[model samples]
Target chain A: MSEPIVVIRGVEKWFGGLRALGPVDVDLKPGERLGLIGPNGSGKTTLINCLSGLFVPDKGTIVYDGRDITREPAFRRARMGIARSFQIPRPFTGMTVLENLLVPMDYLGSHERSELERADEVLASVGLAARRDAPAESLSQLELRKLELARALVTEPKVLVADEAMAGLSENEIDDVLALLMRLNDTGVAIIMIEHIMHAVMRFSQRMICLETGRIIAMGTPQDVAQDRQVQKVYFGERAGA
Target chain B: MRTLPFLVIAALILVGGLFLPQFVGNPYYFFAGYVVLQYVVIATGWNILGGYAGYINFGTSAFFGAGVYVAAFLIKAFGAPLPVQILAAGVVGMLLGVATGYLTLRIQGVYFSIATVALVVVLETLIHNIDYLGGASGMQTIAPPAPAWFGGQTQYVFCAMLVLAVVAVVAARFIERSWIGRSLRAIKASEPAAEACGVPTLSMKLVACAISGAIIAIAGAPYAYYASHVDPLSAFSLTIGLNALAMPLIGGTRSWIGPVIGALLLASVQQIATVTISSEFNILAVGIVLIAFVVLAPEGILGLIADLKEKLRRRGARP
Candidate 1:
């Protein structure tokens, strides 16, 4: 509606002459849910990396909150309210679950309440309050994902880009993560969901966009995109045929 | 199993030092004791980058040698006070640490460690070939006001202990509670994930290196003056780099007490063995002990204690 919270214009990225992703344009408004579904090597993760400042696109610019962040370092971008959780949870193995949250909370010094309280609350938000004292190594698959989310949440981010928060999980586990994303989105935080879990992304996303060969081939309501001939031929044809 | 045993050993050293006068009415034991305490600072400093962040820095000699030189040059040239000289160690160490961190932190683990080793060599050559401040022949580092004011060896011991006390307390507090410590732990576990979380991994690595270097340099300042000698061979010696790491591993780099114990035990052995063995054997003994410890106890003495404690706990003794 208003100025998009994130604007990616004509973004082109390449890895050693392999034109991985490209000259694409997308805008995400505040609190909007974006479901980015793409076939393997379709550059979904590559695009997310560009948006999160992991890799600078060779061409085009990234504008966030009325500022061009093309040259800002990843940490500076994070401090400026951008947070992303890895596909595989990386919970600083030596620290407790509570300590993982504390790392990002340090930037909130004098800007909020005590770090310990904020850390505990974030742990609670991710349903990890019970495991607050547990070493990150001891956490199970679901718990590690929760810890990852808690770590990002503690940054009090405007955008939370989760790269495959639910992968290789059972149906029940998928529901658990979907519910968590829903709760995060409900809190007025924009979420960029990059997932291969089709049904989960379709059900959870307010809108869905599908990619094929690093190009956005289909973008519409979940049903419309799913029924679209291009998506069906590329995605469902492979999975269904397999 | 971690640093606890080292604390007990340091206590024993303190108690024995109090009773040492009955054996010799001189400052010899105090001087040796000062070296051990200073190593505690050095090893702890090295561990912030080496053990905590999982980045090995053999360039500790650079910081130690730098401090000794700075202190000597200041006191010799401008007659700067003792406090100012100590501050110089920290400032210069941190600055050098930043350079090392920036250049090497982005590389892999072994490369970073090799960079440090090479850094020591490059820095040593630069200083050894230089002309001012006594060159390779070295300068005599002057004693601070403590021994002169209180007028005895005991006061010097007191001063060394004071520095050790502050260093240990500050180190323990930071590594346990501070934000920098947590980020370091993250980097240690997984750098890619840490970067994804916006850790500024490179900067943090350098900051750790700098602080570690600064502390080691400051610790070496008084030690140089206590010995009243600062040769490039002694201060920037590769052996100093080796000894700095030995203690942290033996005592259990996981905790604050590990390096302290490692330093004290090895120092005590060296001190006692000096009476029976030659000076050349002292450094050789360090290498031997490190090798023996590495072979016999991969987890170090603290890890051994932890294994024993677990056994005792299972046997219901811990209750």
Candidate 2:
């Protein structure tokens, strides 16, 4: 493939003296579907935080789109086309659903179409056209997830970091989000999906990485990593004495 | 509403307000009206940061008292006119606001509120020690002659306060309608989410704090002339802070109209209470009404009206 769109190297993060994440490395290729799976406290979210400019790594560098972004602010990274969805849906309350999409559009004012047209297009793509005018507080759980994704997609980011975007969603809802991500990737948008749902991530990710306690335990094609001994142990609790 | 139409309506209201002294000849009317309009400016200013940006500022007295003293200083030092005093006070208040926001905005929620209260204490102590601007004792201010049209000092200051009220309300409306308002609402909803969406949350907050401080200071600028005396105790009185917060909550925090409705209602009630009952009942009255609104219609009058309208619309649609 062409040069990786994102290159993360030797990133480390510590909350006080406790090393919560990193001393790890990662690289994301253009239009690639990268799945990151780990158990609770496994530093998946921590890594995403470091990558998205929320928490600058105590050590190491994050180069994005051919520039070093390790010290960049979160908003600056977002403007440079790094977008993310929160694990919990954070709809700008008091605004309507369509207006929620318009929030990001106000900042990234480089879109070809007007904000209204772009917002409408995003809402329709996420299957929320009918609920466009509804207040954000009135959305159901599944709809809120769609809104989270729609907001991330609205910026037209080259890389979308979806942190637990499908968590707590039903089986069919998972498939719905998977299809949305697939369709988005088809349009040349790379996605890094941090998910706890096993089967869904396995299906969506072309390549996968399994993290355990801030360290990468396995990385390769989905089948290879799923069957890797360490990943299996981490997922299934030592697999009945091997 | 569009910008031009909004400004035109604001001008019309201001012109109509200037005629109030003509209809009511009593000096007491202008006195009470001035206090009420002062609350209008303070509440609207406080709402820009407190209601829209979701940062509770418990230090209204800090900005207000600073404005009062700034005006007093300008008058005593340079024999400055009202407009110059107002302009100087606004600049000082805005600087204080940015300084406060820069130092404390990283700490969210109650911590931010607590830091603001500490700011009031710090500024009050500093002013108490400064001898030039009256110190612990008070300073008296004599007003310049009123304009030929206004006919009296109280009436003149009342019209000046009315103009500031219009300016404050119009500025608040402009903020509530613009992209800054949208970003502030987003920040209020979730700061991290707003940041992730490419909104500079801290800078947006600083802008809100600056504008809020300037308007609030402008309200306090004419006060030294109105009261004819400025003292640390009364200038930095806790009542102003409480009333500023209460008015916005009573009216609703969602839009510009909420604080205006709230300030008018609550300030009018307090005025009536001070006159009919006693000066002691003023705080008691605000306390009771605030508790009632907080427990019952927490969204203030606007939210209540919107809910009522929604219920009525739903009913009408059903049959």
Candidate 3:
């Protein structure tokens, strides 16, 4: 296999006296669908934040595309083709849907196509063409999630970290988003889906890792990880009881 | 190419202003016109950072006062021309803006605003201690004689302010339509999201600050020449800061025209109130209008107009 597109080695993070994530290592390959699963406060978001350059690891190096980018700023990482959607959708308020996509496109200075055409295309791809001129504040919950995905897609990113992209979504809506992400993956984009929904993540990931107390308890194919005793006891067992 | 219309409007306004002194015999009209135009610059400047980026700066007077002092120093030291004084003031204002934005913007939101307010106090104290620029007292300025083409000094200053107002509006409009404006709006909506989307939020904010600071200070440079006096109290008056904030909020913060409209309406009303009711009543009236706008129409007059149009369209469609 080719060298991994992203290599995280010995990455750890601490918030004050509390250790939130790490002493963990992971690798993502090109065009891979990686599911990152963890319980509440189990460091899934923390790990993604580290990967996306929101927080520098207290220790360890994050090499992306063969270069150490552990110290890079979030914006620089974004321009270097690392894009993410917030767990909570943040639509640029007071702006039209088309304008929201235009923001990132304009900043990245990509003009392969006219901005208006590109914006229209993205909006269409996300099934939001009908609402292109609508104010972002006027979007439905499902539409907002689609917008979040579209905003990340506008950069033509190599790695897309979708943080809880399906949380609070109905089962059908989850499937809709899953299908959209799968379609994106078919175009050769690597996606790191950080999710709490087990069935969806299990169905989506070719490889999955379960995080607990800031450490990876299981990492393997979806079936193997699901069948792992520790993953069941620490993740599924608790959910089954609840 | 898109700016052609704005340029044309600016030229037309300039031509119209040049012919103003020919008709208006009263020097008071020019004086009032200068004050209104000055606020036009201030409001437009404030909106660049405050409206576009959602960074509320309470230190408007600090930049304004810095320009006044810069002009005072230039007049005292080298007897610089009005253009030179204005240019120097712009540089100083831009520097202060960049410095302050660099130091405080990292804190974010209300804390950033408080830091800006503190900046005013620090600069005001610094000016108060400087003996050369008339420390506790103020400096008296005798402006150079007006050029032969302009009938008088007031008309010249009025024309100067008109030019500044035009320039400020044009700059604001350009920014609103540019990539910088879109990035600022994104930053305003969500800084983290904007960063993740590839906007250098801090750098864009600093640029906004520098441009805003320079324009506001440019407004103050002419003030020193117009009033023919430089006092720290009047220069850094809370009213100027309040007006700077209020005008943009009242007119609408979405586009460049909002602040211009707000400043024109509010400044004109204040001018009338000062003459008819009393100077004290002028402040009270502004306070009342601002409160009413904030409560009844947070989007300001432009927003109110848009809402009304939407309502009219809906009604027409129903019929």
Candidate 4:
């Protein structure tokens, strides 16, 4: 795949001797759809944090676009074309939905006229044109999630890490987010989706990897990973039992 | 075209201020007017960082007091003119602000506030032990003779403060409509989210700190000349700190007009209370008003007005 967009080698993170995530390796190619699923406490969020420069991994390195960014600050990483949406939507309160998108666009040092145009385009793409002028605090749950996605997209990141973008959505809403991710991926941006919704992940991911206790236990095609004895015993078995 | 009306109004205010001494006849007018204008500067300055960036600064007196001391030192050593002193004070204030922000802003939220409070104590102590600056006592500063164009020393300082107030308000208004203001609001809403979205949060915060510090300190510079005395106690008074925070909150921190409205209203009331009741009663009044605004109008007068407008629009739509 034309020079992996992001390469993670021997990444490990620990919180006071309790290893949260680590000794993990991942490579994301351009336009790749990678689904990352793990049980709770499997360090899914921790890995994403490391990738996005929120927390420096205790060991190993993260190379993005052939550059080592293991120690870069989150803002610098974002400027280098890495963007992510929060599992819990964090719209900038006291601002209109369009203004929320404009924040990142402004940071890009774009012209004021173009920034406004870009903000409009992003809002329209997210199906939030009607609510463009509404205060972020006034948005419904679904709209807030869409606003989060729009804010991420405004930066035009090369890699988008969607951390549970469909966490609390209804069945149809889940499909809607899945389709949106697919469309976004089609734009030549690699996407790492960490989701608990199994069917959505299975249908969206070109390849699936399951993590457990800071370790990758299974990695393969949807059917191959699902039918594997270790994967079913550890991941699907726990879901079925619950 | 949009700015024409604002520029015209500003010019009228300046011209009217130039002739204010002609009619008032009372030296007391300039004296009281000077105090009101001083709060205008302080409140507007405080709002830039506290309101826009959501970083509550409990050490307003530190920057203000630094300016007072900087001016006092210059006067005592080199017999610096008022203009020179004001400039020096702004620089010192900006430096202290940047230093304090660099050290404390990393901690963020309430912890950052506590660090500011600590800064006040540290600065006050440092100034107290310095005998050249009068230590705990104070130094008397006889300002250079007022310019021939002004009638008296009080009038000169009053005009100086008027110029500063206008400049501070104009600067604040410009910032409110700029990208810097939007970034600050984003940081205020959610620092982590703002960072993830590519805002250099620390750098933006430091810029806010420097501007806020410089403007507030500029306000204190004239006080050194007006009062003709400078002491650690009054220079670093906690009342100034509290009032600085209270005025912006009471008015509305979002726009420059809020602090202007708040400082004028609050300072006028305090002036009246100080004369009719007692000087001590002024503090009590400020405390009461601050609490009332915090509880009843958290967004200050501006937020309340916005809410009322929304309600009226809803009513109109329903009918």
Candidate 5:
């Protein structure tokens, strides 16, 4: 189609000579549901971190919306409409769920409708209107994930990278999140779902990629990647070889 | 909304200062009262960074000491007016705050606190060794200005600043009620989440530091003039740091007015204890209160009021 919305070429990150992830390249298009699946320490998170500007890549350039954001700070990337959810949901403890949505809205600095109204609508859209005033620490795990998504969505981001949003979630909860993300995809927001859960990810993602030891071993349709020799060996090795 | 008692108490202290000779008639209490106000300023400032942002800074005395040395130098050399001296001190403190924010904000855990403590030691050693800014001998023979207005009177200056403090409290209260205040509270609660949601955590923290440093420094100028002189030891000493932390903890870090209340009440009690019991016991006494309150009343006296209100509400609803 047209140029990809996100292009990562020759990206590499190392922690003290340990290449946690890279020399990797990937492209994400507008309104695409991309599933990034990897075993533990497969560099999925690292790649996401580099893309979100959490850590500067040791090498390679990350182009988003036709500009190189390789050296941008996390906040600047957010301002440019790039957002991500943490692997561990970090709802601000002691703040209401509604307030969690409102904090990021302040970054917009007097844009669009009233700030409070904007926060309220975001909360409602996430199915957290009833729990808006509740302390974040008190939220159920699923609710926390929803609040996390609402926060990323509040920036009106073009790309929302959800890191392990389905981790530790029940099967039904996983389905719930899948549906929620699908709804957003329908609204033209590209979502990069980094997950370990196979069935849910397979059902949700239009395309799936498998990462092993910081390198992409497989990238194709769910069935293709799942049936790939290396992917099957890695999962089989974990069960019997380990 | 929770700051009413504090506003009233601060007013009462000012009124009490008016008729000091008729009541306790002790200059020592006035001295202590002045110290309390100064501590309120420090505690409030430290609370912005330490209490609100959860960045514990042990180098408050460094900024306070900067205000002390600069104010003393201006008065000693050029004979600057109190207002001018105070204004200069505030600007210096704000600048120092910016520098500290830049240097230490990136650090997490004990490293941040250590950086601040190290800053204090660095500044203190510089003052102790250097000949200018009073060195070891310290500035002496300072004459506390009576100010020309109100006919060279303490009452006039006191009234004006007391009015100013009231205005400051009001503005602080208004901020507490508004959007910026809520954002600070959010950032304080969880910085990463706040940032992800679009709160500018770094800038919010820097602004807190700037506002905090400026106010604490402004509070110092009057005290520097009141004491008539300041040495490196008295100005940069851990006493101000201890008092600052203590007042906020004792009053409860929950509300904006908490530190102010803690400063006045705790300062008054210590003054009376020093006179009636013994001078040496004063330090021991406040230290005890600091430890005891944090351990026993972690919520502070204000939190107690909230509990009492809840109990009363429950009782009224009983069948």
Candidate 6:
């Protein structure tokens, strides 16, 4: 592959005395679809948090587009085109859906286009055009997830770290979101998807990384990582110790 | 409303208000109007941070007291005029705001509020010890001669306050309708989400704190001249902080008009209560009205009005 868009080296995070994540390394190429899968408490969110500039790594450096961004604040990182969706929907309260999109557009978007048109386009792309004027608090589960994705997409980010964007979504809703992500990937934006759903991620990702207790247990193509002994053991509990 | 038309209307109304002392023979009206207008400025300033950004500032007295002292010092040392004192107070209050925000904003919620309260106590004690600013005792300040057209010091000061109120309201309104206002709302709603959207939450909060402090201190700058005395007990009065918070809540915290309405309604009630009944009833009135509004109309009069309008519209549509 050509020069990677993001290079993370030896990133580690500690909460008090407990080590939450890493000594992990990851490289994401331009327009790449990377799947990050792990069970609960496996530090998937923690790793993404570090990558998105929420937590400064206790050790290691992150270089984004060849600039050292390990110590950058979250907003600066976002302005630098790295955007993330929260695991939980965090729609700005007391605002309309269109106003919600206007916020990021106001702060980080290109001023070449009218902000309303850009916001409306993103809303339509996510199938939320009908609900554009609706209050964020009034959205349903699927709509909230779509809003989360739409918000991330509104930034027109180079790297979109979607943390459980498909959780609590219906099966049909899952395919809809999956198609949205695929379409976005086709537009030359790299995506790091953190999901608990196996088949959906396996289908979306060209490469996969399985994390267990903050360390990578497997990294390969979908079929290869799925059948890996270590990944299978982590998923199925080693078949009762053989 | 568009910026130009809103400004034009506000200017006309404020200029008309400046002529009020000419019509009313009673000097008490100007005296009372000064206090109400001062509250308008304070409540407007308070809402910029408290209502919009959701940062409760118990240090209203701290900034106000600082302005009172700053103006007193200028008056005593340089015999500076009201405008100069106000300008100086704004600068000092802004610095204090930046310092306080830097120190306390890292701690969220009630912890931040407690720190602001602590700031009040700390500043109060520091002011009490400073002999130059009259220490535990108070200093009397004499006002410069009022202009001929204004008639008296009270009327002139009332005009000055009316101007400041307009400025404060316009500033608050501008912030509400601007990008900064949207960013502050985002910070209030969710800091992490705002930051992820490239809002720079900490810096935006500091901006709110600075502007809020400067405007509040501007309200206080003329107080020494108005009251004719600056003392720790009165300058750092508990009532100022209470009313600063209560006025915004009673008006509506969501928009610029809310605080203005709140200040006008609450301050007028207190003034009338002081006139008709015992002066002690001022706080009592505030307490009763505040509790009623909190219970029955938690969103304040503006919210109530909006709900009423919505219901009326729905009814009309049904017909």
Per-prediction DockQ, in order?
Answer: 0.52, 0.86, 0.85, 0.78, 0.52, 0.80
* Sort by DockQ, top down from the best: 2, 3, 6, 4, 1, 5
Candidate 6, residue A223: how far the Cα is off, in Å: 2.2
In order of appearance, the predictions have TM-scores of 0.87, 0.98, 0.97, 0.97, 0.91, 0.96
Task: Judge candidate 5 at residue A41 and give its lDDT.
Answer: 83
Q: Residues B25-66, candidate 3, lDDT per residue (tens digit)? A: 898999888999999999999999999999998999999999
Tens digit per residue, CA lDDT, model 4, A1-242: 39998999999999997999979999999889999998888989999999998899999999999999999999999989999999898889978898888788887876668778888887888889999999899998888889889999989999999999999989988877788888888898889999988888889899988889999988888788878777787778975567
Docking category of candidate 5: medium
DockQ, structure candidate 2: 0.86
The regions of model 1 sitting more than 4 angstroms off are: A110-115, A240-242, B1-24, B78-82, B139-158, B161-165, B195-200, B278-285, B288-319
Query: Which residue pairs clash in candidate 6?
Result: none
RMSD of each: 4.0, 1.5, 1.5, 1.6, 3.2, 1.8
Per residue, candidate 2 scores C-alpha lDDT tens digits across B1-319 of 5789878999998999898878878888899999999999999999999999999999999999999999888878877889998999999989988999999999999999999999889988998899887789988877566777887889989999999999999989989977899999999999999999999999999999999999888889999889988999988989999999999999999999999999999999999989899988989888999999999999999989989999999999996
Residue B130's lDDT in candidate 6 = 88
Off by over 4 Å in 6: A109-113, A238-242
lDDT string for model 6 (A1-242, tens) is 68999999999999999888888999999999999998888889999989888889999999999999999999999988998999999998878898888888887655555878888899999999999999898999899989988988988899999999999988999999999999999999999999988889999998999999888889989898888888888864655366
Q: What docking grade does candidate 1 earn? A: medium
User: 4 or 5, which is superior by lDDT?
Assistant: 4
Residue A163 lDDT (model 1):
91
Report interface Cα RMSD per prediction: 1.6, 0.6, 0.7, 0.8, 2.0, 0.7
* lDDT for each residue of candidate 5 in A1-242, tens digit (9 for 90 to 100): 87789999999999997999888999999988999987888899899989988789999999999999999877788889889999998877756787677667766876456877777887887788899899788899999899889889888899999999988999888888888899888999999999888788888889988888988899999889888888888754665455
lDDT of 5 by residue, B1-319 (tens): 4567766876786676555534453445445555555666677777766666767778888888887777777877788877777789889999988888878887765797889888889988898887767687676626445644333334433443454355445555655555666667766776665665666778878877787777667666665567666778878878777777788788877567877788778877877877789867867878998889878888787877777998999999999
- After the best TM-score superposition of candidate 4, give how far the Cα of residue B198 lies from its true spot, in angstroms: 0.9
Task: Residues B69-104, candidate 1: write the lDDT tens digits.
Answer: 887778777767667777887788888888877887
Candidate 3 deviant stretches above 4 angstroms: A110-115, A239-242, B1-4
- Residue B97's lDDT in candidate 3: 96
Report the interface RMSD that candidate 1 achieves against the true structure, in angstroms: 1.6
| Weakest 10 consecutive residues of candidate 2 chain A by summed lDDT | A233-242
Candidate 2 residue pairs that clash: none
- Quote the lDDT for A116 in model 4: 83
TM-scores of chain A in all candidate models:
0.95, 0.96, 0.96, 0.96, 0.95, 0.96
